[model samples]
Target chain A: MPMTTTPAEPVTPAGPTVPGEPAAVAEPRRRRRAAAGWVLLPAVAVLLVFFFYPLATIVWSSFTEPTVGLANYTALFTDGVSVTVLLRTLRTALIVALVALVVAYPYAYAMTRVSRRTRAVLTVLVLLPFWTSVMARNFAWYLLEQRDGLIDRFFSLFGIDGVVLLGSVTGVTVAMVQVMLPFMVLPLYSNLSSIDLRLMDAATSLGASRPKAFARVYLPLSLPGVVSGFSLVFIVTLGFFVTPALLGTPQQSLVSQVIETRVGDLLDFPGAGAMGSVLLAVTLVVLFAVSRIAKPTAALNQAVDRA
Target chain B: MPSTRAGRPRSIGWGLRLWVTAVAVLLLAPTLVVIPMSFGAGQTFAFPPKEWSLRWYEEFFSSPQWMSSVVTSAQAALLTGVLATVIGVAAAIGLDRGRFPGRELLRSAMMAPMIVPGIVVAVAIYGTFLRWHLNGTLLGFVLAHTVLAVPFVITSVSTSLAGYDSTVEVAAASLGASGWTVLRRITLPLLMPGIASGFVFAFVTSLDEVVIALFLQTPEIRTLPVQMYDSITLEIDPTIAAASSLIVVVTTVALLLPQLVRRRRSES
Candidate 1:
């Protein structure tokens, strides 16, 4: 509801006017609202019939398909593969969120302090990946992560050997962290820029050390943004498919890969549906929980709109 | 905030500055590496190719499969962009101009495609399209992608509408212009930048999307990304580098086109 980033929508001022205009204005207003309703019908109807209906069918099949009980959901737990992949997926998502937060916080903080031109450049850098093709970026990561590639060479210089990033969870995580950083930075920047830095200044002036002042004041205030950023990154990484599939081996598969296999190779629609349903549930729950503390919608809008 | 006496800028120390620079490099370098790799003369996925040529680009341009996929992708993206812009512009106008019950609810519904995970939508749409026999069709690609692309259009148009002055429409109406004419002559012109941006974003969104495209792809009707994906996973061909660079360049220009348009509009 706190669409803080967007300016308020202006009310239309083209309502009907007549010489005797009191009661007649009400009828025209009703007609205008109806006209607006008509304008809205096409897009809304298309999404509902195409998008939501399909989504619901898949979720429904998770329950009703293959004998109409909780079998599919129960199988997800009892089946060793789904549970392991689910746990690995959760663990990977958490690591990506934490790592992105560490990198993004200071970068976002710097964005606030820099001169306007510098800020513009930094903003462009942050957004560059967002605009770049996803497959292209992933391809570049593949080139770097492949055997004896740049990453291996970098590690070799430090006397570390056989450090192949490809076909491993590490490769996927490294690529994913880059993918998720913008999501983290934009929200954190939005939150950080709004914080009254004077609080830190006030604390330092009161004889508190600068570090302690920041710890007690700035860090706490930035938590909402941190929470928002973490959840957003976490939720996205949960259902990530392309990166893990491209960089990772089947032996170290994430939940997304498992879901893909179930639907694509195995043709186990019910099973895949169940897994997809759980992924959707987790995403929504995390978003809902974050919404309570921070304006996830506002954070998401800032991240997406980059305004 | 700087404490009036010490009116220098906020003291972002060297450590933070260094970290930010490193982060910026980390964000940008990987994507840029593809450009050079794209022009590599070698067959293997080698960096700093011992020799250099546009061999891969030549291959990409010559291969019928790649060419056909390119055609499919271009057609889908163009269709998705146009269809989404129209529906989204209408929805933005509806949301902006109308005061109705559940208006906020409807607005949130428009954004749902963005919130839902890509793979989920891909599978769901894949499954549903299968039942409708819509899979492997341009209409399928367009409809699925339009769902994804519409949200971008809606957001862009809504942002533009937020800053728009509705009084111009009122002025036109008071001068006895018809509702449709006022909208056509005044409202649409004022919102052109937003509308243009919305179209570009939608175009780019459809152009770059791969998850849903992958699900809906058939051997006969696949897109460039599906080809690029196959080249990566199914084969070790380096020609994907050329395709990747081309895509990155195209999408970057498409995304920036709006910014340039807006800047030019403001200057004019």
Candidate 2:
């Protein structure tokens, strides 16, 4: 957190909490137990009402409204456009995650070698775009990548409009990359910052080139953060709506957009629910697989501080 | 970023430094372009304007619709900040201290709103709120944003809680202090940074949010991102630039101020 100078300690919140009054020492334990139970109910209610209920409703609606079974899913799997769009969503997410890593690794490497002051500034900068609405920032990329837009003008001087991006998959990828880059960068930076500098130094002193040192030592050590970042971008990208909506043609719709159209355009709640249930199932499977290997503290970049 | 440490080169191989710079820039190009494009001063969004003008700047301020929308967004963001911070902080504290059943599952469930697609929530809220007669009110937007935003508050506040030293409270307890005193004097101060982090995240989440806003906002109560969405689809004038510019300024300020404070806090 930008509020402190050192790595914070992990102390669970149990101190001096309503338990140590002059004559109330004995009374506080019972009250503390009561308080803990009280906390449990609200937390449980919030998660259930907001999360499990909606998701379960989606699953129930998908199978029930259209008739309970994986029939909707069966239709999805057997249909021409359905499987293609699903695969496209996953493939695009993978590409975005891969590109973001390729770009973030070096920036993170340079960042790890910086001073505290510079590190803070860079961290803030990395997070600033994230702080703004991704919709707006994605629009910024849209404007930049628009045909004959800002980026096009620069390339125009060299007779290169074809290279300019507007509605192509590359344009969508570029915008999505920008939106997801911070997701990739922050974790990598934090992980690198947390790395012991001695290892890198030792690797270099042993005659490994900088790249070699980074590849052999820094890279391996930072695997958790890398995996964390990739999963962060990957999962979010799977459910992405705006980037593809703004940048890609109708044919290029990802699963999220398909769900959006099914819900918003067609008013087929059951079909939409079916699509959502599928995505949720896939996400849980992937995340479970990821948790099996590396858990990003079960936090999972929650909403871009991220989040 | 010739990233050396402590007044000396970090022993990084020179051959790799350029490679790093090139990739970083290539990666960071989209971020860098916002500056120049933001300064573009023509009627069109052409990157390098034929002529420089502050007319869009003037237009953004003078347009009542744009001005009012900006105000609406700030209002929503402010409300989201307060509600999310309070509820999120409370949840974080409870989760950190208490170990009841299904706590892990609860945490995951609460965090799912953030991970789930905004459109999914938008659709669900649209249907739910329409039934509740909450279709186009500021209250609906707040409640929706708050739900989406709780995870940020939880994560950021929990980040702070994780760093908190339970021993301090223990010391306070041993010294004949009550829980209230220990929390007031010791815990809150230490957790200020994390709390601030939660607050900022909440603010930004509300501001940048469009999916939920789309389903919620009436012409009577459009937030900035919602307004931007309308402008993007409804009209193609330079006024949206003015809107974009205002958002850019406010967002940049929001992003920079905490770092400034945090930097000053640490340095002094």
Candidate 3:
């Protein structure tokens, strides 16, 4: 009777039904939804096995391996090189984030002011580096920053002779700013484009000069985008590996390089895991703080959709 | 949009325009520089090659090591694309329509891979893969890459899903069509463009990925990016210029492919 009932039942939401047969009528729809729920299973299962399991393993090892009770984590602070590297990495990330913001803010603002076609071209410029291979870009910087390379030669034109950028923290910082520019621009553009230009005119008409109006009205409105973009770049630069490894010297290595050496060369899994945990903790902390102000993920998704 | 002043144009001033142009040039310099550098005939990794030749390209194609790495990368990317898309699209649909209690949590979890730092991911996966015997294997690379690629696929597919009207699907189902029939005739066609783009994104994510691949690589199973990394760090190989150019061309075409597909679908 149950099987036959499903076959004869009207599937339409508007179809007439007996007064007391609501449960029977709703049964097939619920069954259909439950069937659709099965589709989520494979993805959840795969992530559970492949993604979460591995991450959990590292988190576990950080505390458990090489004897438990926080020995590994304590070493991260007591070890001279690790603490210094962590601090330097944070300093470099802050500098990169600030420089990228200064460079990207005007470009993103200009993107909002341009004609439609010109705006599209500007958008591509921001995305161009994003799609470029990381190794390739780092290699390009390696060539330009080498001793007596183009950068040095150009500096020499101003009588700043014998300047070498390669193997210096300055070189790594310069290359990273370039790599991080797109991340900063996309979010800022998305936020800036949505702002009404009429508001700026309104401020100017209210007895304010152009620069004063921009500083007072426009800057506050754009803070959400700025914070998210700045935080995103800062978080990414903190864990950077390739650019620093290629363009920077061992003495100037960032946190990522330290982690790499511990894990890859030293095979010190517990120590590497502890340092990685700290990096993850820092990233999550920044992400949470930024999420309180702006929706980085949504802004990122919107930017990608537009692209 | 007109200017308040008689002679003042209502557009960005020259200062901002010049600044934007400079920033754009800085953004594009690395990609633009690599193409010319790829043509250098000399041994040094210099720009504006004194001698122009295709020697690096010849070397890239002629060497078995370079060719094998390319083949391995392609194989891994292809598998990652397929795996990520199938599961990612399904999850997107489920999250979009299915009534679930933890839907928001699930969505965030799906995007977690994108936010997690690459070095942490590499170390974590490398540690577990050592125990799982997945280290230095193609399957290992594909699995690890799929985790990263899934987020891109999910984002692209979810974007397409946002514009999709589900009422049409309901209409089909109420007209005596089976669920499978409705999905096959309605949902797949509408979601094809998104799915295609998601596939492209997944492919590119895997191909461009380096940190995780760098750890997983063995002498026998190196991907192109890893090989490129070695060529630079171990020794300065001008042949990497050729490889970099090839990657740029390949990625440009791959990223552009979905846009082309969407255009054709719209025109038809």
Candidate with top TM-score is 3
Tens digit per residue, CA lDDT, model 1, B148-183: 888888888887888898767656655667566766
For candidate 3, give the DockQ: 0.49
Write out the backbone clash pairs for model 3.
none
Q: How accurate is candidate 1 locally (lDDT)?
A: 0.83
True contacts kept of each: 0.59, 0.25, 0.51
Cα lDDT for residue B18, candidate 3: 90
Candidate 3 wrongly placed segments (more than 4 Å): A1-29, B1-10, B252-268
Cα displacement (Å) at residue B95, model 2 = 1.1
Candidate 3 accuracy as TM-score: 0.92
- Candidate 1 chain A: worst-modelled 10 consecutive residues by lDDT: A1-10
Per-residue C-alpha lDDT of model 3 across residues B1-268, encoded as one tens digit per residue? 2335312323888798899989989998756667888998999886667999999999999999999999999999999999999989988887776776778888989888877777888898999899998989999999999998888888888888999997676567667666677667888789987888889789878888899999999998999999999999987889998998887787677656765686689779
Give the lDDT of residue A303 in candidate 3. Answer: 84
Candidate numbers sorted by lDDT from highest down: 3, 1, 2
Fraction of native contacts in model 1? 0.59
Q: DockQ numbers for every candidate?
A: 0.49, 0.35, 0.49
Q: What's the i-RMS of each model?
A: 4.8, 5.7, 4.4
| Model 3 CAPRI quality | medium
lDDT tens digits, residues B1-268, model 2? 2222322434344644675656555544565544555556766666655666667767778877777877888888899899888778777877876656777877776787866655566676666666677767777777777888788788887888877887676666667776567667877788887888788778878888887777677767787776666765666555565556556677778667766786689889
| Over 4 Å off, model 2 | A1-30, A40-43, A201-214, A297-307, B1-9, B19-47, B167-186, B258-268
